[model samples]
Target: MLDAGLLVPTAATGLYQRSGDFEDAVRAVEAWAGSLRLDAYPRRSLPPILPRADFLQTDYLRSFPDLAGIVSVFTGGDAEHRALLEDLDAGGNGSTVLEPAETVLSSAVCHSVYPTLDPAIPDEGLRLEASGFAFRHEPSLDPVRMQSFRMLEHVCVGTPAQAEAHRDVWLPRMAEGLGSLGLDVRIEAANDPFFGRVGRMLAANQQQASLKHELVVDIHDEKPTAIGSTNYHEDHFSVLFDLTTPDGNLAHSGCAAFGLERIALALLSRHGLEPGHWPTEVRRELG
Candidate 1:
């Protein structure tokens, strides 16, 4: 059960250690991130959670209200809560409803990716690894829904066609990679976290347009939880943040995300954590 907190407390000594499924996921994602950043990767984070002005430009906050709720805590609040809320409230005087958000933290970390873009990466293609802690506010204490969580994403920004192609290239590789570990994986059209009213249209168009795909696992009672996702934001972030291609055309972006906790939970729930008894093949891959 969710014991009323942000990040779930674990009895395991080294949470980052590859001692269990959750830990293994964390470790692997860290490895991937480290390797990617080493090759001159360019990335950025929202100075504050995110300004209401910026989100409005991209319609990102309106689309993903849950994440926005987490961003709102930054606008104003008590010191302790402010520690987590990151000053991203967009609700001050405009349509920014993110002020004093429901939760003092982000419900998920991946949303932070669209908020910033580093223009230095040559536009032939840009590869990036973004990882961070995210919070979601709700009654989801299941080993699956810890209020605060971690996420790792690999992003590629270029042209619309290239963005889709990038997703295509990684989708199968990821499926096979997870499958090697005995995960039952499937791809499907996924929905964005669009807030209310007008934002729904943007989300619907994005979905109908098949701009995103999620790699899900059957974690919660046979209903696959989205562990990995690929999104093609054709000029959404570029136009919003003014990201451009080497050729000076508006760049299109696609991202692949791995929900650290959810993936870890899936690993633990399906396979035992003990390195000795665990499948030798998968264990070797982790090492």
Candidate 2:
């Protein structure tokens, strides 16, 4: 029988603990990441928790203000704590103080990679492999819409043609990679959730320019979830970080990111509770 508690929803909405077959599905996702051998010289590094100033430079705040996760620490000393305790003891609600920290939790896996580069790309280009936890504020009851999740991304930086070509090649491969695991996948043009009224224009331009594409699969309802995305950022990061090609032209960049938890949820939702009974190819690939 399928355990009802496979994914334990936490008190915080959109957060979940993976257990039972859910964990097994995530293991399968790890194997999928390992199977990709496209990098000629992949720059592997630990994920970064970025300084607030660094994150501020990105258009993240402008585009995703509602979803950004700020890191803060309690600024209260013992005296303040005692005052709150006394207030609570006297039947009043306790109050706490929190101050913004120097850093914010990572919102995207590739956000920090560009700043760490050598400032100039080689003639061939650059490829990077990064994996880490990321935070967002899309609170929901759906297990697939996790507020916190693990992500694996392959980033490419070079000329415009090079960056576009890399996404072209990988988009199909990513769909195949997930489909092999028995998940139904589709690739479609999409746009970022740029904030506010002006954001509508930005999103329209983004789609018109064909800057982003997403691989989606049905998880919870008829509305499909975007499990992966391929983005062609034309000089967006290059201008921000002053990145350049060997010949001094502005560099373009692209990335393919896999949402590990969403992939796991899709697998369990489609294949049922038993990982052992998953497709033979998927079991062998995961093993």
Candidate 3:
């Protein structure tokens, strides 16, 4: 992709400036995914940064602290600023002068959605289609493992049955959608990269309960990459966000998230770098 000018690299690993062609491919993939169910769900557009208070509520720090990207800024006075500059000039890390900002880079697009929902959901439940940028602290040379990426997600909040059904329905649908794009796709049980030993137990329980499933495609010769995922949070967000069903039970949440850049890369890898030259059916589907 770098050789083809589809991706422009920066000094930061896992971060790249996408080309027009790359963005076009991303939009095409997003459009294709949206066409699958956009009309049924209300749409939401959220910022990439989340309120620190809400971030704390999500408990991401407990589960994936290693991947969290906290936004820190210089909130110092003039004297402090001068000292910070002098420190930097003296080869000292200026970050030492920075303080945590009110917001943190969102780890997932869906994290911001939960806070927006009502404390009590209706019987039919709530469903939304949201698209936004997401961030993680992991830095890697692998293009597929981008530290910053765009996500398009369909989120459902309701009873456990509703959440499970939402995940179940979308998992295969996403796999088929990607397969239609001429890429070999598979649906498999997966778990989040939780932190530490306790997290290992959480991950094991998550897998045991089949709470997460991923739509994976081969973008590399070595292994398959997950371009999309379906996750069921059984009252996890509800307990934190204080959400409940109309009947008073805690609400369950499920989401299917599509990694736009990863899907675009998969398409480029499978059907050649040129989108125009991709199979006619694939082009038509993307359009």
User: Whose TM-score is greatest here?
Assistant: 3
Candidate number achieving the greatest lDDT relative to the actual structure? 3
Residue 145 of model 3 has an lDDT of: 90
Candidate 2: lDDT of 63? 90
lDDT of 1: 0.62
Model 2 per-residue lDDT tens digits across residues 140-216: 87777788888888898998888999899889989988888788899999999888999999999999999999999
Which candidate model has the greater TM-score, 2 or 3?
A: 3
Where is the poorest 10-residue window by lDDT in model 3?
Answer: 38-47
Ranking by TM-score: 3, 2, 1
TM-score of model 3 vs. true structure: 0.97
Question: Which of 1 and 2 is the better model by TM-score?
Answer: 2
Stretches off by above 4 angstroms in model 3 are none
Clashing residue pairs, backbone N/CA/C < 3 A, model 3? none
Summarize candidate 1's per-residue lDDT along 11-38 as a digit string, tens digits. 6322222234345556674564334332
Ranking by lDDT: 3, 2, 1
**Prediction 1 TM-score vs. true:** 0.71
Candidate 1 residue runs with Cα over 4 Å from true position? 1-25, 32-58, 70-116, 120-123, 197-200, 273-276
